[model samples]
Target: MKRLVFLLSALTAMSANAQGSKKIKEKDMPAFTQFTYTGNDRIYNDNPLKEGEFYTPVLQGCYPDPSITRKGNDYYLVNSSFAMVPGVPIFHSTDLVNWKQIGHVLDRPSQLKVEESRISGGIYAPDIKYNPNNDTFYMITTQIAGNMGNIVVKTQDPAKGWSDPVKLQFDGIDPSLFFDTDGKAYLVHNDAPPAGTEQYSGHRVIKMWDYDVKNDRVVPGSDRIIVNGGTDITQKPIWIEGPHLYKKDGRYYLMCAEGGTGDWHSEVIFVSDKPTGPFVPASNNPILTQRYFVKDRANKIDWTGHADLVDTPDGKYYAVFLGVRPNEKLRVNTGRETFMLPVDWSGQFPVFENGLVPLKAKIKMPKGATNQTGKNGFMPNGNFKFTDNFSDAKLDYRWIGMRNWRENFVVKGKNSVRINPLEANIKAKSPISGLFYRQQHATFTAETTLQYLPKSEKDLAGIVCYQSETFNYVLGLTKKGKDYYMVLERTEKGASKVIASEKINPGKSVKLKVAAQGDAYTFSYTADNSAYKNLGGTVSGDILSTDVAGGFTGSLIGLYATSGNDIQP
Candidate 1:
């Protein structure tokens, strides 16, 4: 009876603490809603046979290259923010599946280069870990624009404060920290060897060296090769990267993502007796991949792998990784998003049964987590209806801007959202006058019916698979003399490629639908939902990386209006 009373008191205190905060103002909210859906939610519910079922993207919209760590009962994750002013966005969760963005690690201009760096190249992967001895949380990141190998920062109280970033002399892309039981710290990195030398090691190799905690440097005498790419190479030209380490029982486990991070790549697990020695591959290599699941719709898109593992308070293990769902017809946008899976341990080794399987079914929330539902909801699952009458007092989290925004693009009146052409063309200097959200699930579809009023030859309006100004897939109506032309442009390759062009009459409203099943994408036009035809050309490869785009967010599916002259939609 005494223990029960104490438990009740504790709960009461937590409730009070949670209620202390007030709702953030509409303008003060983060630039992008972390997990807004760009497609139909039915795609994630299409698969019902997978074990443990499947959930929607927990952290969406440019929430790629995830690095997760657990400290006691709390779990923390940080993702690469790239050119966004605040470099790395940090999220915390009690349950491994549900996450909330708490703060950004680098909030100062000195830590991030937003003015000069392209949107997609500012920040790379970041690894988060807690140092128990010092009682501090440490974050390591790579500044692609600065061309610096890695940078480290720490905070004693993650909720309130963080230290300035300290540069480290390490030549690698994705850098992770492994704290051994003996209190020794080691740095594991994907070594990018000198170019054009066959003897030089590939990115797949995991190299380890003792790190000096006080000086924040790699110790000279502690360098050693831990895992080699030759043993677990993916069937792609790009080598493996993103190495994360964990130790269980008497064995050290190295789990890294393989494949070129495209359609054929995936995650692989290896084990060894020591931290710096030859590691043996698990019986089931590519332990977590969609390659073997031929019939799964989620596998249809290129499911390249990059993963981070974390354990729950109850001692259960989980892995968070990145995957993509491509649309062949509208193939310009290809930013990877986050996905979660449960990990089962057998004896000393960890196993993931549902390897590379897409989330096509509803999943029950873990014990103690809340499940909230709405059209543009806060929960991990659920679809957002992009169709807005613009009746609300303010824009919903479902909408994100394509570039640095201005007040001229949207005018919210009493009944609907009026989108005006801010620029002359889709590829113009002015902002793309539209609201967008990321493509969340692997097999969903997006449909938008738009009416275009082109004011000039440069005037156009329609839906786009947006990454950056250079990397996007656009299908819009452009004014040509007295008529309108339906045009398809592929910008993923940096240079725009006009894939398809057709003439049509202006002022007619047309319905556009973009469908995605795995890596396969199809774009269709219809006056009605029942009839459709395919557009040509498909986008794939590193061109899909966030490094190519300028947005701090992911690929967005939104309406855009542009013109050299004045036009409104």
Candidate 2:
């Protein structure tokens, strides 16, 4: 199996190399000396977090479709990566307030085959569940690319590693595994309506299957539709997805996200007597949503849905879901983020505490625990600064690659990191020689210092603010004739436009910086650590928004190098 995977990867790389993009020798590639990122969003910086209060959106920046599970005192959380290599980032928490990213569930090339897919085509809505019956953990998700449909992978401990994916025999998205106390397992997911029963656009149904745990497959004929058209079939609620099943107090409860994944997104609940049954919608219907809120609100957080629930050892319930914090212009460049709220499952159905109201920027810490944001290696929140000198051989898990991660391009030294230029540029849908970090704040600055002398006009290396293939900004040092120039290029709807350019004599070191103040962005560069000069005065960040880009991911700031440089100024 390992040999087969190697051959497949080699073939894919060969095919990508045949795209007529220029290649360069490894010795002449660019080496980045340092990279620094700082997040200073006004919402986080201005607001004072009182004692015992932490900022919401625990896991920020494009980490959408959150699914969480608890095993005794340990809590494990997983989020959708969507075509990024090493998909399904798994995080661990002991007190729910302080969380740390352990590792990715799909870490190797054999486990994830997404070398040729687009940035948003690989993994979607991964659901992680722990079954005490077998003392195992299962992660199930839909692979939208690579022709790998719904798949499942298991592990005895999440920190060690996960098994190779076991393809499930089912057709749907957002699949979740439910373990009943009776030793029976079940699977629930969002699927299309039955044959010829298609009603309207965005109409979807929730289906359940009797999962055979011994064989790791769904039973042959146990598929049944649990809910049709969301809360009410007659009202025609649309895009009912991200479903999960839970049993409490001798009753089965079904929860799903409804009304699409935009501002109208919401979470609804239903009840049934059996795992697969005639489920009835709860009177409260949408247990969580921000749809009713008026537009043009202050510090707005929108598109709240795709939730999962987990109970603590002491029986306290909490929910984790996805929401977006848009800029003042109502543009979402940070993408769908993960937020948490305590649940009021004390009733017949669960309700997200303050989930229905406008989301608050701060929340009180859970009982007996203090806020741990940015402390003890927990994922940082509010305003923070991160600097990487590339002194360690192992890269941080926050740095990711699109489609596939190539080992040849990255060379980590004692003080710097060199990237062998790839033929594939950022404009192509294929994998490029770039290591990306998601834009975690609405307003932040990313800068990198590199040593590079472009061999020709075909070579370039610098930083990229990438939303997708057609929506991004590339600021790099490229050569024209015999002079070196720093050029900033913008691609909107697949058309490239040169924003600004300036000729410079970068002697030994050149620093490039991309700063964003809400919707406005500026690109600046300095030579030999001299005074910075603005290459692009300021440009609107609308192009980096999902509303304008039409994708399922947030902006990724990357250390990029490519031999096939096409943008010129």
Candidate 3:
């Protein structure tokens, strides 16, 4: 609808700049300028794209543990940003169907300390590697918050930045970084099968270490466990985490991720001569899966695997993993994404082309490339539309921020962007003045255009559909006693309610939207940019879903602000 009438004329100019003549007080904040998202998903408009073709999760929403690396015709790709805040999210491609995000490998803040974790505790499954021996480019991961276990970072230029985060004595959770040809340097991970060697509940274990890479650490005792309970530990395999290690041709491959990322996830393989393994299983072991299919199939795509593997420069081979796409009641509010295929490695165990069945949102472009998704900036799949206009003060790596990225409450004007509210409010686990974005489709529609004037109800300033800090939904503009309302709260496990409120009519300019279709969701607002009104009538997105808000991440939307306002209208 003309982008909803240019998002209601930028919220009627932020409600006429909040009734000019200054004097709004009461902790007045909210400035926002423009924001708009749109994603008509009927399984991406019932699948279209027939030029050379392109589309696969290829990164859609809530990007998950992808990890890829090439560096010749340039490939690079990464995902897994657990506590958000500019954490890992690099991208760039040559023809992997046109990618390009180019930023964030723990951008600053002393290499991301996750200001307070939660929201699925910080980082997890990262793994990006490239080392023509020393041209450098490594990014290992696993920081379930605090103690920041297993880290690593480097960059002989992945786009000109990186380095800081070198803590890896090990303990485990998806580390990786192989590099051998003659120079040697291993370090695979996913541990916990040593002390007592418990054999049941999701028994993990894939160890390996020797690394040192000129003192990046991990050699003290040279650990070794390498695939102990995964592919047929006699049918007890489970959560054998995201471990990668490949060598191919001289033999040595390990690959992992066995059931336990939901719906029995997979991607298995093994074979070794020695990177640090006696390895073997791979009689076609999973090779990538959709768990025996049949969960109501059709436009489905369930949790696939946690892969990583690359090779093009004419060598072929491709993999990248992570998957998800539930909606229409199957639940999973867009988390775990990034998907890719192609890899037949000509026998000796390497498969995935068509990855064992049922996953195809069109593909078939890779011959000479050319799709440049949503044009130059890449990142845009199927039905899409985005608009920011925060007019650059640097911000757009898909606008993140959660456990940290404070940058003094944002500001950046000339076009608009103002936030400054923070008394810690999106249900504080800490750090939140808002500015998120990653609800990338499954029926979408966001919107924003603030310029507030709250002054009470502890103050609040619009839009947020967040999915953590205890499931979310807040739609703003506060001030309760002397008038001016809007409200619409929701939260779910941390408890909250107020599902509706009205009393508007103050100095106008507000536009806040939110729409969905999968699990329903509605909420609306508008102050004269023409009709909208509907606060809380269709709710139930099943608590923004991670199959009921349990979280690994997804569903962001934000642009919020707060003074600690506690929902009440």
Provide the TM-score for each candidate, comma-separated: 0.67, 0.95, 0.36
Better of 1 and 3 by TM-score: 1
> What residue pairs are clashing in model 2?
none
Model 3: per-residue Cα lDDT over 177-219, one tens digit each: 7999999898888887988877788788888888989989988
Query: How does candidate 1 fare on TM-score?
Result: 0.67
For residues 78-185, write the lDDT of model 1, one tens digit per residue. Answer: 887665445677777766655655667876646754434555666788889988767778898788765554888888767785787788876767888888777888
Candidate 2 has a TM-score of 0.95
The RMSD (Cα, Å) of candidate 1 is: 10.9
lDDT tens digits by residue: candidate 2, 1-569: 66664565345344434543344443456888888999998887779899888888999898999999988899999999987877999999988888899989999877787777777889999999999999999999999887789999999999999999999998989999999999999999999998899999988999999999999999989998888878898998999999999999999998999999999999998899988878898998788999998889999999999999999888989999999999989999999999999998888999789998999888878888777777777898888888888887577888887775645466555577767677778898877778889999988999999899998898899999999888899999999999999999999998999988888998888999999988999999999787788987889999999999987999989999888899786
Lowest summed lDDT across 10 adjacent residues in model 3 is found at 18-27
Candidate that would win on TM-score: 2
The lDDT of model 3 is: 0.82
lDDT, candidates in the order shown: 0.61, 0.88, 0.82
Candidate 2 — which residues are off by over 4 angstroms?
A: 1-27
